[model samples]
Target: MSDVEIICDKSFSDVDSEILDRFVEFQQAIIDKDEAKLDEILTEKYELVHMSGKRQTKQEFISEIMDGTLNYYKSEIIDPTILWDDKERATLVADVALTAKVYGINGKWTLDTTVDFEKVDGKWYFTKWDN
Candidate 1:
């Protein structure tokens, strides 16, 4: 019955904004079905774990998108919380509503997801995502 308290570093705002921007760009890439844009957003070692517990490498995920096995219609991110462990690494957790088709099955889903990012060469790239 007590109120909960949430705290994060104040200096994270700028970095969090940049990371959030990248996340939005990532979602847009899916909606646009732009493989090149996706490639640009993900790190070379990127991996994704779907809500169904399916795991994919960066190339596999991109291929699925390119071949229409996975199609994204919309994505809405809500209440994203970002934590920076250091200058080079951070984690973002968010509630997301997604409208999509996976392997020909169409559905809308709401999921709590986490994405890990790493800063390399002055840019943030997604390294891992789990939903």
Candidate 2:
């Protein structure tokens, strides 16, 4: 076989780092129950799929949070990996331990989570998440 060269380019750039930082902020917003900040960080089309196969739309989710129906006390993300499909779309996968009260049940859960983000108007917003 002839000599061949292969290039592997999977390194995260500064922009990607910034996006990851924003994601961490997003997690914090949930823990802090900051409705306004969550509003800014989540896209209008955001959706969440719970581990129990329940789904919530953006407004429904936000309303639950605002009403204290779904409260997040804390979240610790471990070994996050980010993959950008293009300039506008990215996926972040990580193992996370989260403490929360949902639907009147309070518990701590460790889960493997996949979060999707989209870039709109030069800003990144969380579009969806599932575990």
Model 2 agreement with the true structure over 6-110: per-residue lDDT tens digits: 122355578877777787787777767788999899888899998998999888888998899988887777667788899899998877777889889999887
lDDT of 1 by residue, 14-130 (tens): 878898878888888888888899999998899999998999999999999999999988887777888888999999998788888988889988878899999999999999999
TM-score of each: 0.89, 0.86
Tell me model 2's lDDT, rounded to 2 decimals: 0.80
Instruction: Report how far residue 77 has shifted in candidate 1, in Å.
Output: 0.2
Candidate 1, 34: how far from true, in Å?
0.8
Worst 10 residues of 1 by lDDT: 1-10
lDDT of 1 at 28: 83
Candidate 1: residue 72 lDDT (0-100): 87
